[model samples]
Target: MPPRRLLLRGVLTAALVAVVSPFVHVIDFFYRREAEGVKRQKIANMRDLTPGGFIYFSYPQTGDPKIDNDPFRQFVLIMTEDGQLRVYSRVCVHLWCLPSYIQTRRQLICPCHGSIYREEDGVAIEGPAAYQSYPTNALPMGKIEVDGNGDIWMVGVDGRIGYGREWHNIKPDELVRRV
Candidate 1:
């Protein structure tokens, strides 16, 4: 009721707002996302990998050395028979060993568990899938696109990212920047 008391109350309210406003902005950082999103890395050449040919590379090349041990970070590009591009995660569906393409066999074969996948698309054809406790699931594939320039972009990992469980599936087009 006193003017002095009213002035003190006003000061307290202003101080409270000053302290809490930043917290509101911090909370928004976690919840708010822009309508236009991030740009994906152009990891490989589309034309270089002819049908059945393969090339290996890392995705999201952060400066962290600890990343060297992550299996999902590795990927391979395979050109399909019709020249459609497919980026297959190198980490095998079973036992998490990196699978390599055996040019002679014309398939991506896992050395650790002997799990095999077709080069064009990841399909479980043999190996660990036959065992009761072993996995029969196909290796995760990357959603791919060939831009107008004919460069291949890894848009997103098709399923849960390799053994690491990171998801990079923000569609490649979402990250495209306008000139």
Candidate 2:
């Protein structure tokens, strides 16, 4: 190759590296950082929980209206037919659309893309979410425990909430727009 062509190629390669490195680091930073801990919030009482029914609630209670009321923060607590309690975030993994619980069907269905997930464990059963890679295809879940007093408290979320791979990595402007 000509010396001038080689020099131009080298310059372009360096420029590309320079422009792309920062974003790579930023993405790496988000992936490496630990998730923000969820606040232990009492969500429902077992005595009040009806079997095969659903209860809606929110988590973390960040106090910032944008974060607190963001649709992604919404969750559903359900009492399975076997009497086990499970909680799953309402945010659909495919497109961040809220999935509605169909009690009769025992599944969470996303209206946006018709993605369906098992209500028992938030596993994507069909549609686009089912076709995505692991975890991305699964809905975000919150860990809950029931105390002796029958109060159910949400202790933590299995993964970051919302549209992205990391919940904390969501764009602030999107949160503002969502709110």
Candidate 3:
């Protein structure tokens, strides 16, 4: 390429970066803040939930009404018959519809598309969600643990939330900040 054209290209690239950098930084900042906030969110007391029972909670409660109050942040905590705890995002992987747990069937069913997920694993076994690829077909899962006081705390979330952060499963000990 000629010197003038090369110079113009470099200048344009630099200008684009300069314009985009701030937005990128702002997004990264928000994502980091949200990730840290979700680290130890107390969902419910283990004693309050019985086998085959479930409850809903939200994560990354950032105190921003728009972001925090969105239904996509909602998750369901289910207590299995063996007393193990499992939490899955209510947002259906198909088209962002909310899935409710059918206790009698032990499945999460999305009414909008009829996508069905197995309660034990959050895997889509039927309908549109089942047709998607891998993790995209499965509901995002939140990791939880019972504290010494028997309070169930959501520690981390696995997979991508609805158009949000791609958070990997984080252990409780790995969280250095509390929100």
lDDT of 1 by residue, 1-179 (tens): 89999999999999999988878667656731321112266766656777767778766556576774567677877765665566667877667788897867778898888877766546657887324221235556665556777677765555544432224434323322222
Better of 1 and 2 by TM-score: 2
Per-prediction TM-score, please?
0.63, 0.68, 0.72
Q: Write the per-residue lDDT of candidate 3 for residues 1-179, one digit (tens) a residue.
A: 99999999999999999988878666565556555435677888868999999997778666788877677778888987776678888888888888899999989999998999988677789998898877577777776667778888887777676532244534323421223
lDDT leaderboard ranking = 3, 2, 1
lDDT of each: 0.63, 0.73, 0.76
lDDT score of residue 16 within candidate 1 = 96
User: What is the Cα-based TM-score of model 2?
Assistant: 0.68
Error of 2 at 162 (Å): 3.2
Q: How far is each candidate from the true structure, as Cα RMSD in Å?
A: 7.0, 10.6, 6.3
Q: Given candidate 3, what's the lDDT at residue 110?
A: 93
Candidate 1, pairs of clashing residues: none
Could you tell me which 10 consecutive residues in candidate 2 have the lowest summed lDDT?
170-179
In model 2, residue pairs whose N, Cα or C atoms come closer than 3 Å (at least 3 residues apart or on different chains), thus clashing, are none
Clashes, model 3: 0
Q: What lDDT is obtained when candidate 3 is compared to the true structure?
A: 0.76
User: Which candidate's lDDT is highest?
Assistant: 3
